[model samples]
Target: MTQHIQEAYGYIFEPKLIEDLCIVAAELDFKEGDQLIEIGQYIKKMPLLLNGVIKIMREDPDEGELLLYFIEKGDTCAMALTCCMGSSKSDIRAIAETDGTVLMVPIEKMEEWMTKYRSWRNFVINSYNNRLKEMLLAIDNLAFMKMEDRILNYLKEKSKLAANNTLNITHQEIANDLNTSRVVVSRILKKLENEKQIKLNRKSIDLAL
Candidate 1:
């Protein structure tokens, strides 16, 4: 666990900060599909990912849920940082996209480290900036891009996160993530397949690009 922390998050913090984190941080392992945070729940700790992928999502009563962004190895969730900084409850959810490990710093430690460690402040700022950029890109895609382009971009991102050109996902799953109808998703996927952009099979999509 110590080695994993050093390898994943060590460079982001000063040696003393890293040492202090390791002393207080508890290691947690999550399997695929595990929920890291739930909507409307209070967050107690912040996670520093050691390995694997986490999917951040926004939930709504009428619209359901949508994929917001992905947190991968050596990354931290910006939402987690915000929730941990205050008494507010979580407005989003985080799920383990793959089996992974994380070093969780207690909420108290996170606040303390902000003032006690320069690296922590930098990490927090950079993480927030990166997440904001990702969210803005998502909004831009929704506003300026056509559905076909959006679908393609979504597939590309999924492939990247899974580290493979072939994705083991269903059309309905894609629809849910994009907050569209399954029929629409299937039609678009078929069009992409006809154009040789992707190949579709039972519950899978193979990128031709």
Candidate 2:
């Protein structure tokens, strides 16, 4: 565990802080589709992703859910950090997008590291900035981008995160993420297919663009 943290996240903290993390960090593995954190649940630990992808989503009463952003290898959840600081529960949901491992640090350690280690403080600030940027991008797409353009951007982003142009997702699932009806998603997808931007299978989309 110590060696793994040193190799993957060593640069984020000083040697002593790293040693402290090694002593307290708990490793957890999650299968695809597993919920790591759910809305309104208290966060007991802060997770540092080591491998695979976790999708952070915001749920809506009428819209179901909207994809906010993704946290991949070597990233931390800014929402979880927020919960650790003062919030009692989480407002967003985090689900494992693929089989992955994460190092969970107890919430109590957060303030200690922040005060004791300058690097840790910097890491936390950087994480918040990155998350804020991604969230703003999501907002821009939802508010300003056309539906077709938004779908295209969604496909491109998912392809990159999956590390393949081939996407194993259903149209209905896409509709749910985009907060639109499946019929609308299908029509737009068909248009994209006619333009040769994507090749559609029963439950998958292969991007040609």
Candidate 3:
């Protein structure tokens, strides 16, 4: 597990929700470029990243492509509760941006806990709080940061989450993630390289920070 997870959700390890639920927490590992999930797949479980990084991206069937936004370690893969009420707002593709490890919790187990135990609500509350905090942070960045600043911040955040000063991200994917053009992303990357802030290659970045 990354140190950030302990810093973020220390409550998950407490003895609170262990009684009624069969906690199937395990350290699952994956390599870079691996697809942990595909678009439109039924998200029957929530995944908690224990280490490394993952991105939650949306595919455009109309445009014939995808846009990527990172979900770092300690973020949940499935926003089940929100979509449980209606036609899913977003189709998620979980990309293992770097090697990753995660803990899986099936929704059925959580449902059982919700029915049988009052304390199970704590987990749900915590999950929503964390997700909301991330969403708000995303909004703040989009509103306040320039395009370059957004890219810089994104790389820096992913670098830290990746447990290294290097980032494994595709420029095209980042462009899609930031809602910018690919050529613009390439130009920004060049600027970052000239400034000695990062070294960009075909599929990854060596972040100087």
- Report lDDT per candidate: 0.89, 0.90, 0.66
- Candidate 2 lands at a TM-score of 0.95
Provide the lowest-lDDT 10-residue window in model 1. 9-18
**Model 3 lDDT per residue over 73-146, tens place:** 55664454445324364366677877867666666666666666554556567767776676677778767878
Q: Report the lDDT tens digits of candidate 1 across residue range 1-209.
A: 66887888777877888778778989999999899899999989898999999999997899977888999989999988899898689988998889999888899888888899888899999999999999898888778988899899999998998889999988887888888889999999999999999999987899996
Runs of candidate 1 with Cα error greater than 4 angstroms are: none
Count clashes in each candidate, considering only residues at least 3 apart in sequence or on different chains.
0, 0, 0
- After superposing all C-alphas onto the true structure, candidate 2 shows an RMSD in angstroms of 1.4
How do all the candidates rank in terms of TM-score, highest first? 1, 2, 3
Runs in model 3 deviating more than 4 A are 1-11, 16-29, 61-69, 72-74, 81-90, 115-120, 140-144, 168-170, 199-204
Which portions of model 2 miss their true places by more than 4 Å?
Answer: none
TM-score of each: 0.96, 0.95, 0.70
Question: Whose TM-score is greatest here?
Answer: 1
Candidate with the greatest lDDT versus the true structure: 2
Q: Give lDDT: candidate 2, residue 139.
A: 95
